[model samples]
Target chain A: MRIWDPSIETLDRVSLRQLQLTRLRETIDRAYHHVPCYRSKFDELGLGPGDFRNLEDLRRFPFTTKEDLRLNYPYGMFAVPMKEVVRIHSSSGTTGKPTVVGYTKKDLESWAQLVSRFMTAAGVTDEDIVHIAFGYGLFTGAFGLHYGAERIGASVIPMSSGNTDKQIMIMQDYRSSALVCTPSYALTIADRMEKTGIDPATLALKVGLFGAEPWSEEMRRELETRLGIVATDNYGLSEIMGPGVAGDCLERCGMHIAEDHFIAEIIDPETLESLPFGEWGELVLTTISKEALPMIRYRTRDITRLHPEPCRCGRTHVRMEKTRGRSDDMLIIKGVNVFPTQVEEILFQAEGCEPHYQLIVDRQDNVDSLTVEVEVNDQIFFDEMKLQRIFIQQLEKKLATGLGVGVRVKLVEPSSIPRFEGKATRVIDRRSR
Target chain B: MKVEQISIFIENKSGRLAEVSRVLGEAKVNIRALSLADTSDFGILRLIVDRTDEARKVLQAHNFTVNKTEVVAVEVPDRPAGLAEILQILDDVQINVEYMYAFVERCSGNAVIIFRFDNVDEAIAALLGRGVNVLKGEQVYEL
Candidate 1:
């Protein structure tokens, strides 16, 4: 197995913690002094950078939630000024505001390096052609993996997401070796190849680096068999540095967190208390080396357990199990994070639409589809069938535009959707994998 | 003369159409004429019933999305070009027929056709002016 940076990845526990302590202190100072959000948070707790005597003392600080990022809006959480920032990425929020993160020149360099570590561990080499299927732009998955592959001196074919037929065409013509995309998308490509009577064995694909959505071991096996490639899972989020935060090292036991750059913590989501190794809990990460945005104990909401035991592959960083599930009700459809509230917001704004609605998510033919079922009311109902269809289609268009993904709006009879007592069950996810 | 037509929205699933019919049947509503328009996802069941308001109220009570629309019923000449002549008369006056369906019962030995037009009043005026018999709401309901 290959390790991108041996000095950091395979550092001894004593030395790694020493490095983490030093970086943690520096990050704390930078965040407390520069970012107003962190500054006030530390001030409210009556703490400062000087109080950090050791790694354990770092827990006294407050945890930053996604709401904090929204509160700050675009650039309020950055420790550096806009002039020093070079790149920007954001995740779509439940409402209109997105959680944005910026990167300085050095930050971007470290990001690529971090990403390269995981891709390298997943068997991507300079001789291999890396085909990235994640869409580029505000979403960090594509650009993060793109730069990381480039850093490894790999020939990158930037085939951004969608156009599955074209993706297969490029894969065949370009003779690409490594496939980078969501696991479901890879399956979609496999389905396309099968329908077109193309054999997977004829392709040159050797490894697949799949992420951005939770997939199963069964799906991994299915993808491996159909695509004839070694499928591996990588984990990351935009709030932290994207894609390179952790990944499997061919061992496939768990994804090794880039502990040198991030300080990973498992905490009970309800009590906000830290959990022991091998216990399932919400993953919280504090950016120790990030320059533009120094995140302090950001709750990832991803539920997983950490394995502190050393792997046969020789990396010392703790390995996290594939995220069992999320601590929240956010749904990942086609790798895009969608909150039920986001769907509700759009439905509420639609005139004559009842507040009663449900979101049905199902994976059909390896592609995720969202169907928004809304209860029909007199205000929106039309006497003519043609007018009713047009109304429903207009609502579908509005939801698609608002959600950034295709959605089918289904009109149900009045009061058909069951009314719940307290928290409403708004989402019905039938995706088996 | 304008006639009342009830339209019910039904999801395209097994037993939905049967459920609508069962509800209307239990309410003792007499269906005079009927048409079904459908897409892959859903269907709209349109009916000219003996009592439009009562049928709609009953369907609504049963959680069906029911709507009432004003359509016109015209007596078509019972010959080969009976329906064509009525349509041509409306088209000559530039009246658009949104949709049309046939009634089961006939009036004065002529075929009674239910027509939903974009402009109901104008369609009735054009047909009545051409000596066409436009059945009143009561007459169609009785037939």
Candidate 2:
């Protein structure tokens, strides 16, 4: 059995707030003194550290955005100098430039402890051999989990993404007791496992910590059924010091936020005013213990709610619902909110088509139209005219049912569409504003 | 004897045939003979083009995935019993003709029928041994 540090991880509501205030004050002072950007923001706001007495006063601090990080560029936001920085990670800059993050030696240790706490929350122990499939690189996911598993004395198989055959081979050979990867990749592995005649339950996997993308309860149920393991959501970002900010406990309710190292707040995205608990709003995070970069009220842009209710796992860390969608990435098609992942689910369930797809959104006659181009697998073939008509009709109907919006379906030949090994870009918004 | 052919996978949809044809037309590739084999969801568009290599290259360059397949083309007289005689020979040899489509014969008063079989070589041998005129790759391309 895994043990949790209740004193730090499960501080009561009052103590948690007090600890947050102290940390916030110290963090704010450090940022103002070290980071020129934070200093300028404070000067512009005409505020000082004394103004922020508690978590409620966090709003006084100026919000930090991805653009702000880009403005500062590499290492400009560092509270400590370059000599102290130990590790660096970055987000995939699919749209623009990548956001780089840095950490010190103590920061890495703290990150590991937080990740370990997340694993323990999911019932992972030293006996569990964790098969980590998250891609390794400047990306924080692989190393964060690797360090956390090491911290817990668990045997970790660093199986970075792809080579599905090898991943399955090692899983069976090593009898890995746990898995860490994005939920989508987990399903891919599950599908491959089924095809290879290996029962997921028979594998040594007992739990899966899936994150780095927003997924639904329906998806969670599907993953649980396919892998025959308890699937828990782990939430973190490179901006917030990687995976370990929070995770789902054994009860599998909401992910418990690590209130000790980070302070989380729900704010109305439009007004930037704090919202009451349980209200759907934008999530904001502040790194309290970070050395290299101690961000204050960094706007994560992830829409979710926070639940302070005590978890059955006995951890007092406040929990947050799975992120609904990025405020910037959410698509409004035909007056309905459509997520790329939603379209992905429908495509996954569609018959005789590869998962490779692209969604082209165009506007003509002031009406938004969606064109979903899916790659047809080579194994399936049809008589020409009849096949074309039937495929188009079936896909349109399925899209209507799945997304509640009618869409034009284009069936293209396999390998005709672009494939991404990292973050898949499925949406193309071409509507003229 | 030679023949040029283009094999393409197409999903059943309105304007799909027109789109493929338009693409070929835009590329200045002429289709000599064409046939379609389809299922409930999708179809394969097979064509013998005026310039097989050019057509294949143009289609592939435009991101249309296509395949080159060997198909046996037999010259038969443009008479009521022309196809029946060939079918009888194939049936006797237990050669399953997966699909067959008619192509205009360059020689007057005769029609060329393209036969896609489970085993192309065996089908070609059966047709040739039965005194049927089987076109080679060069001959079909020339036609």
Task: Write candidate 1's Cα lDDT for A73-181 as tens digits.
Answer: 9888888889998999988786757789999999899999988999999999999999999999899999999999999999999999899899999999999999999
DockQ of 1: 0.62
- After best superposition, candidate 2 residue A250: deviation in angstroms? 0.4
Q: Candidate 2 residues B28-121, lDDT tens each?
A: 8878788877765557889988788888877777656577767778888788888899999999989888777888655455788887777777
Badly placed stretches (over 4 Å) of model 1 are A195-199
Q: Against the true two-chain complex, what DockQ does each candidate achieve?
A: 0.62, 0.17
User: Cα RMSDs of all predictions?
Assistant: 2.2, 12.6
Query: What's the TM for model 2?
Result: 0.62
Cα lDDT for residue B102, model 2?
86
Number of the top TM-score candidate: 1
lDDT of each residue in B1-143, candidate 1, tens digit only: 79989988887889988887788899998888999998787778899989888899989888888888899999988899989999999999999888888888989999999999999899999999999999999999999
lDDT of 2 by residue, A1-433 (tens): 3446777775788988898889888999999999999999999999887787557778777898877888887779999989999888876332234578999999999999999999998889989999999878777889999999999989999999778889999999999999998776787788788888998877899999988766789878988888889999999988889899989888888998989899898999988898988999999999999999898889888899999888777788888998886766556554344556667766766663447788998866334688888776533334334445676687788776666557888777767577778877778878643
Interface RMSD of each: 1.3, 4.6
